[model samples]
Target chain A: MRYPVAPPTLADVAERAGVSRQTVSNAINNPDLLRADTLARVQEAIEELGYSPNRAARNLRTRSSHLIGLKFQPAQEGTANAAMDRFVHSLVETAGGAGYHILLFAVGEDEDHLRGYDDLLRATAVDAFIVTDTYLGNPQAAWLRQRRAPFVSFGRPWDDDAADHPWVDVDGAAGVDLATTHLLDRGHQRIAWIGWHKDSRIGEDRRSGWTRAMHGRNLSTTGLASRTEDTVSSGHDAAAVLLDEAQPSAFVCASDTLAMGVLHTLRDRGLTPGHDVSVIGFDDSQVAQVINPGLTSVRQPLEEVAVEIVRALEGLLSTPAVVSPGVLLTPTLAVRETG
Target chain B: MRYPVAPPTLADVAERAGVSRQTVSNAINNPDLLRADTLARVQEAIEELGYSPNRAARNLRTRSSHLIGLKFQPAQEGTANAAMDRFVHSLVETAGGAGYHILLFAVGEDEDHLRGYDDLLRATAVDAFIVTDTYLGNPQAAWLRQRRAPFVSFGRPWDDDAADHPWVDVDGAAGVDLATTHLLDRGHQRIAWIGWHKDSRIGEDRRSGWTRAMHGRNLSTTGLASRTEDTVSSGHDAAAVLLDEAQPSAFVCASDTLAMGVLHTLRDRGLTPGHDVSVIGFDDSQVAQVINPGLTSVRQPLEEVAVEIVRALEGLLSTPAVVSPGVLLTPTLAVRETG
Candidate 1:
């Protein structure tokens, strides 16, 4: 027997099964719509022909694309926050295993961030969205909610406390607390906190952890807090000022990027890290791992977060959709040479 | 004066335009199939109703998805190579401007690399693919070719010299030459080369640059070349062995990851990176940028590569499709503190 030059199509399977094209389509897309005997014949024919249904047609028949829309932002040039790399990897793997793919679109710096989401929604291009930007007062979650769009955010709705959206977020305060307490347990007081500006809700949350830990021990955090942009240079400058003014023996930074800056400041001053002072960073980034002295950092449970996000998506897309409350996971410290 | 709770559908547009649902579908998916006046009437109704055509229906009508499928691999842990972050960002932006989005899928370690491609093709989930894996003897390109799939790769087809496929790649040899020559110009004779093992086609190509540059100056590279895995620890070990055995005054690494290792080894041996021993690395990664004193390395024009790939795709998808030959872009040296 000669091999067919072209792969078998749905019509080929229908003809082999002695059924109409609609019967084969229903058998693949909505088996419940077909009788058991007809479905069995179609299945055998499909297997014999090695037929794979067209996704577009299947999407129309099922009213689902099994594609999740995600807006991919440009890489921040100087920041060492590679959290998205690991998170995206995990999300893709988790979603793929669940028969879903991530459809990524780019938005311009000048364009409104919601424009991409609106366009995708208008075209019905994806079944749902995986929103990553849940920053303070960010309108994406609320906007999607207003349009009754199904979504799962990687962060909590910081601006709207009453917003009941499906979300999965790492507990930043808990993570920073773990770091600060670790340093305190190592006999360090005057633990300085280096974080983002006060306007940043996430930064404030992380800073509160350090303050709470310090206050619990009756240590004044009056001049040990420095807030600035989340960058290596800012981190470096903050650490320098804190060292000169407050002379803190330990530092708990908001991110690994900031931690790298603290490391730089220590190196410049000829002070040995973890000896003269201790440093702990958040987000166990690749930089934290491969730096000269391994960085002690708060590693977010990103893999678990991805699994949770996919779980939420599945629940949202089910026939009787279930909208679960936000999931908040705690991060663990990855101790190394620094702390 | 009142707002409609539900969005407009195809049937609504057809009714407003006094046409059948098929006419409105044809107007959106294949305007060429409709009479000019009838198409204009349907367009007016659609604009008035603010109707966004369903992507699935459009796909079925046009036999296209306006999507490019890309397999996103898990991020390599412990490696400083963040090229994908930059490349993916660029590809998404470039493709988005051209009215196409990226559909990302994940593959299991034990599964064939082509399984994802085959599944996507069989399902007609994407219009084409952007292949990134062009490693030596990799079966992906050959398998895709055998299936007569439309694709553009990010690396040259190294295993098959006669293979003609649209690809955009950085000139690895040229990048290494630039790095080597910079060191040579700085009065470095014994320039050791630290690169990946011989099995990697890209690594071998990069090593050739060092060999060619050394031979061009009539300098013996007999004991100065060392090969290992592309990792910081491997680079450290190679640098240590080279310093003890050959005592090279300068070093050129295949990647920033390896170059970082050399810096660690130098620090361990009481040698300043740029002062006592010159060093250069490829892929001017974020690590190279933020590392102390900065790292002098080669920067691939990944944005340009993305643009070229999109250009090739546009040409391939145009009416009566045009296929272009491989495009090779040259990389430039990012002069910083190291070399």
Candidate 2:
């Protein structure tokens, strides 16, 4: 693919600076080892010739890809999780600024997720991976640990028992605590909680906060909980079931998606949301603002989450000897209309 | 980082098969030059030892990457275009199946997009780029042409000019025509058009279809059009303004997002959407099925569009001589409850 005129290479830069090729490499990769004057001369020559190091050649030389792989399961229709989208944007921007590129691979429904991870690693397409979803017996994490591959999870392990790898996650319990406290402060005595029905550790963490808050306030938690999938329609159905059992003055939801369903159900029943049943949601995603009354939800610190995840991965790549500690960022409540 | 026991390389394979290293390389890269028995023997040997060719090594040797870069400008919160998300998924899937990886870079709001393109090209980080969005005076396209870099766009060039590169796009005019005819067949007499209020070639193409169909039917186009940004709130505002001037029995929208706004407005005004004012939208994304009344929309053939774009890029790379022709795929109308 070379044109009539080839690009200036390390050798060309070295020749222009009247130095050896190793000098140019050090000036670029390990500048501290070189003297100030020598580094400046090499840097000037490199810039004057627009000498960009070929990533492929560098990968071959160092046996490391300046690429990070992020296997994303795109958000679905009902929730349209804009928060995840923003998180990804932040990850890309932060990684790129540090001279790394993100290789995006779509995880298909009926595909072998672990095999994809293995292929990307074996092919040297990525140096490290950022895994966002960690479920019970996640094969991707298992395989990565087996291969001693460099990888970090964006969420905590399914249980603390497997917190053997690097991870960064938003504190779900703290997030719900903020929302629950806000609702309690508004004088809503009978506050219920809505969450995903699946046995997710993240969901349970969020529920624990409500349980703790309610218990500490000498309030009963009986007949005040409903579980459904994190979707608007599911939330609506959960609300119907909850309302049939008891009358709660407020509801704390697991996601903005579920909150939307509750909002729809309330609107359909000709009930004013904040007055009849104040509701709050977690993951103050973009959908929170779009809906009428602007759902009062807990805002995940996505920028910090992404930045710390990248920093964790960087630490993992640089060390490769010790396990990095997990980072837990507290989510804050973004109060608007509903609650 | 080769392990203690290195897997069989070409030299090892050649030694075992009593052939030259050149023969092994040909067997892997271009097996047509090898005899049937020799090719089968090499393939069997490769599988027996699980010898996967290292991609980074091959990239340095051939000066080509099995990587295609796509700089995506994520859809905004107002519209949060799910259609584009589906398109991206399709692109990643098709590209992955063909042994190509997608390097995703989030195109920042203030960053120079052309500079990103130029950097990726100069760094040899990608073999080619897939340009999905093209507008007037698109600097990215111009720079690629000037640099003789390989690229294929997913949309047609702006202003019908700058058709110097390969592209594959769905026929917008035909898409709206299908929707208009579907509505007309259902006996809708007064159908109005709503689309993004920008000088976009794609928007104009869709509007022309509605205009042509109405003119051909001897219907007056007066007071039957309104424009807004591609968002639900914008759609709602547009409807509020248009209702003061004329009351159309049906609204043909440019996107599913706009259809949502119309539905919301109808719901707020205590009017049943499908019964009071029929609505149709374009880009039958996931949101179409999730809403109260499903939206009848024109679905862009995303899978075909992605596949064709990849094929066009492949053609461009292999030939590297002529501009590959733009492939225009026809979009189909998905009939749902709204219309």
lDDT for each candidate structure: 0.88, 0.77
Highest TM-score: give the candidate number.
Answer: 1
What's the lDDT for residue B278 in model 2? 88
Docking class of 1: acceptable
lDDT of 1 by residue, B144-215 (tens): 766656788999999888775689999999999999989998999999999999899999999998988988
Candidate 2: where are CA atoms >4 Å away?
A: A1-53, A160-162, A319-323, B1-54, B160-162, B285-287, B319-323, B334-337
Residue A322 lDDT in model 1? 78
Query: lDDT tens digits, residues A1-339, model 2?
Result: 322123467898999998999999999899999999999999999876667788788777766667888876666765735565667778878887777788878767897777677778667678788988887667677767655577889888775464577888899998898888888888888888998765877888899999988887999999999877887788888888887788888999998778878877887788888878898988766556554566788888988988887787777666334456888999999887789
The count of backbone overlaps in candidate 1 is: 0
Candidate 1 residues lying further than 4 Å off, grouped into runs, are A1-51, B1-50
DockQ per model, Cα:
0.38, 0.25
Candidate topping DockQ: 1
Cα DockQ of the candidate 2 complex: 0.25
